[model samples]
Target: MSQTNIPLLSLKNISKQFFGSTVLENINFDLYPGEVHAIFGQNGAGKSTLIQIVTGDIQPSSGKIILNNEELKIHSVHKARELGISAVFQEFSLVPQLTVEENLFLGSNNTKGFFLDKKKLHQMACQTMEQLEFSIKPEEKIINLSHAEKRMVEIAKAFHTKPSIMVLDEPTASLAENETNQLFSMIEILKKEGIGVIYITHRMKEIYKISNRITILQDGHVVNTDSVSNINEQKLVELATGRNITNLFPEIKKQRGKKLLDIKNLHISNSFIEDVSINVKAGEVIGITGLAGSGKSAIGRACFGVNKIEAGTISYLDDVIFDSSKQINDISPRAMLDRGMLYLPSDRRAEGLIMEQNIRENISLPSLGLPKFSNGFIVNRKIEKDIVEKIGE
Candidate 1:
């Protein structure tokens, strides 16, 4: 994509302060038409704040947002959309009870005489999804859609407005490899249509894959801005973190220990794994890597008793928790956890932890029932706090 010299959108001397605390300091950035300008940063690097300013979710304390060489004052998201600007944030903003078409045109003038124009809505939804090359039915309920499909719906909603500039923040956070490729294809389509994309992500691979220009932001400050080809992966990491990862990595020691977990002839029904065998030893950091739907998560879920095994032998330290041939199936999540085997789900917000709880509460939640933290039923706050603090550290 060949971007023009004049930027479609520009943030000059942008600085934001909340409660007298400076979050963004003199940030200058640009987004040219038909350009994928990526912003790389660690957590608290003010990426969200910058996007919020661009989308009119918040106003900057100082700086000017120039659109097409003209000054623009965007006070809200509605105004931004009206000005040919749109954003697809990391969080999904769809109602679970609503259908895809309904969520796509939500808050829009899709009604005729107080009645929803279903045919027109469907046509528009399908058209926008076709443009994005996403496969999802218009009438499907949002609750029934998978994470990837939900993400696509969000993007489709944003793209339906036909914005000149689009902001995508961590768009591939929950998507699989194939789904990510699909998103990249859509981005390419956007580029061809002369839509300026401000992509914010922490993934280095994505930066090299799609972005034309890379801007590194560290501690809410712009460190460097250059072409992706000009900066390699190692250089990118150092620019983002201000340190080399090789110096932080612990030395690998070649030592073997007794087997802690052993699985043989594992077969999960309705999954990609037909026959799998693996052994985990003490003091071993085993990694099970595969593409989307390639049985990596299946194996972990099966070991945690979350997924039923059609045929397999799962042993934990010589204790046969599950053996299909022997007709012995006593595997349970509680049993696995009690046996010192833990599994973290892929969707942390939905399955792993309670989003409403604070960090201390979430950390102590799983250990509340243990003897050290609880006396029969009541929890010991002092002991729990002490343990939780150590675990947090």
Candidate 2:
């Protein structure tokens, strides 16, 4: 499709439902050549459902999906890819057992009829990684890579598909600023190649920075679609939330309470972090700000037992406490949770959420074993739904 002609992809009056509850209602949208289109919405607003339908992961109950003026029969995800559609899901779909090169060339590896062509696959993988300026060995196993490295590998894998349309679901959630910039550069490269991109994110700054157009979804319906130039940040937030987006960090209403957390001389090996010290007072909102690799997140992990600390002492007031002599590394995630410390990871889909689980289970998972529900060792089901409904709102 020409840049000035009809859109490369179009969706007219799309709708979806589950068990009589409508998730997406009469939604319409379009994607044009060389344009970065963004879809913004809160959780459960059908943004995922729309992506699923477009990528053939799910079928829409009603609507017409036209690509290049031809109606598409998106029966399955594999079928979508066959039609030059690719998605880097919010959830990591990578097979960690495989090498980075193998993950990159999973299905499209050059094969000699019945046999596999390993050499050509590795060559193509290396070339693609080099193009992204990602420093990682093609032969390295995915389990050996850090979170950022794994995210980079996923992007490399997406590129190997040679897609006409690529959907990135929160691509920058785990990426550093430099890595995000690199991805943006790659997106520009794709745009020049006439490929359409659908970027899904909650970060308004990203929509302002990279997207050419924006489509906002709320309560499973389309609110509006317009050029980025036509709307400002406040307007965009209103569209996404149906209300003015409040300052996420609100003012303190009361005096800071007793010290709830304290860390002294924290360090992690080989990572760009060392000798970090911080404290969190009861009912206090503490913000950690720094450039990537500056130990901002590493500190969070060390406190929650996700990463090992070479030396540190954490005192969580009377509720919980830790000493450097004890192996904080030995502290289990359950132990941390038991002590009233919960972590909301930056990568919500990959680390913070279980997409396969329904909305109810995910919200209730943290408190699953609590004594509130107990009848012959089986938890009461009624209370679970109540808890979920409260959180879902």
Candidate 3:
């Protein structure tokens, strides 16, 4: 049978429940070889849950998975990969201590006699990265690389598996415009190679650019599945959110306060950024854009005192906190936080949030010892919960 006649994978009546709460209800989806199927949904709309079940990260409460027209019961991510299902999600699945080459073949049994051929693995990693069109060092440790570089390594790891079905969740979330273009090119290549792809992204343009079909999920139900050409961006948004785009983001007006931050002649140590300057007002939103590894994040990290500043002047509220010329660089993250400045890193799993902690705990961490959430190191659970709930609202 041809690839179009027979689906590469299918899910029938897939239902998932966590502690009596239904996540996915009677979900049915399919992918054909060489097809780019885009899954669209709002947060908690069961998109991630369905993908997790397909890739074996989570099991469905009741369902049937058919792979190549045969029953499939994927119980683990590793087993899924071995069975020609590879995935790279927003949360990177990489060992921080391991090098890129090691991470690429981390769980695979591509060795003999219970020993790994490190040299061969390095060569293979080099070729794989090249094939993916990513400029990353195979010997570099995941922890030492920047957020974008780490994302590239994750993409390379998934692509190296040579899987029949590849899952990419927010692949361009950490990537630059040029990097995103490269990824789109890679997707075209995958389509030609007859590899089915399950893409999950929020970028509306990507749906028409790469995906052949789109499936929208809303409140644990399959809202609709149709060809990309059949749906417009506004229609997709309405279906996914159950509201018009205008209702989702209503117009709001705010008065601009005095200059809040000013960066001039910024230069990051060991990076290519130099002679960069930016000014931000209280109500203004500043966006930094460039190619991957172009120091877009370097500027933010420098302001937060995470990256070393070779030469720069960072002024907060007209006070020079980081001035390389005056040797006045005694700033730290804690000091900035104490000054009412909070910095949220790009990598949530590695930096922003504590993965082991619950959502309430993570949100309450910043104010753990503060008067609102605690009293003299003793936490006030009720008060903290109220404040967190209010913040959520």
Clashes of each: 0, 0, 0
Which TM-score value belongs to model 2? 0.85
The alpha-carbon RMSD values of the candidates against the true structure, listed in the order shown, are: 3.3, 3.6, 3.5
Q: Where does candidate 1 have its weakest 10-residue lDDT segment?
A: 242-251
Candidate 2 stretches greater than 4 Å from native: 130-135, 244-254, 267-274, 290-294, 305-310, 318-320, 325-335, 346-393
lDDT of 3 by residue, 1-393 (tens): 125789999999999999999989999999999999999999999888898899999999998999999997999987898789988888877899999999999967668578988888988999998887778889989989876778778877888878899998998997777778878888887788788999999899998999999999999999999999999988999999887676545666888899999999998998889999999999978888877677787788888888899987989999999888899985787777777888888777778988898899899887775777777768898998998899999
Global lDDT scores for all candidate models: 0.88, 0.82, 0.87
Model 2 residue pairs with clashes? none
Measured by lDDT, the strongest candidate is 1
Off by over 4 Å in 3: 1-3, 96-100, 112-114, 118-153, 246-254, 265-268, 310-313, 318-330, 356-358, 369-386, 389-393
In angstroms, give how far residue 28 of model 2 lies from its true place.
Answer: 1.1
Off by more than 4 A, model 1: 1-3, 15-23, 56-64, 68-83, 142-146, 174-176, 244-253, 327-330, 380-393
TM-score of each: 0.85, 0.85, 0.84
TM-score of model 3 relative to the true fold?
A: 0.84
User: Looking at model 3, which ten-residue stretch has the lowest summed lDDT?
Assistant: 243-252
Candidate 1: clashing residue pairs, number: 0
Task: Tell me how far the alpha carbon of residue 275 in candidate 1 is from the true structure, in angstroms, after superposition.
Answer: 2.8
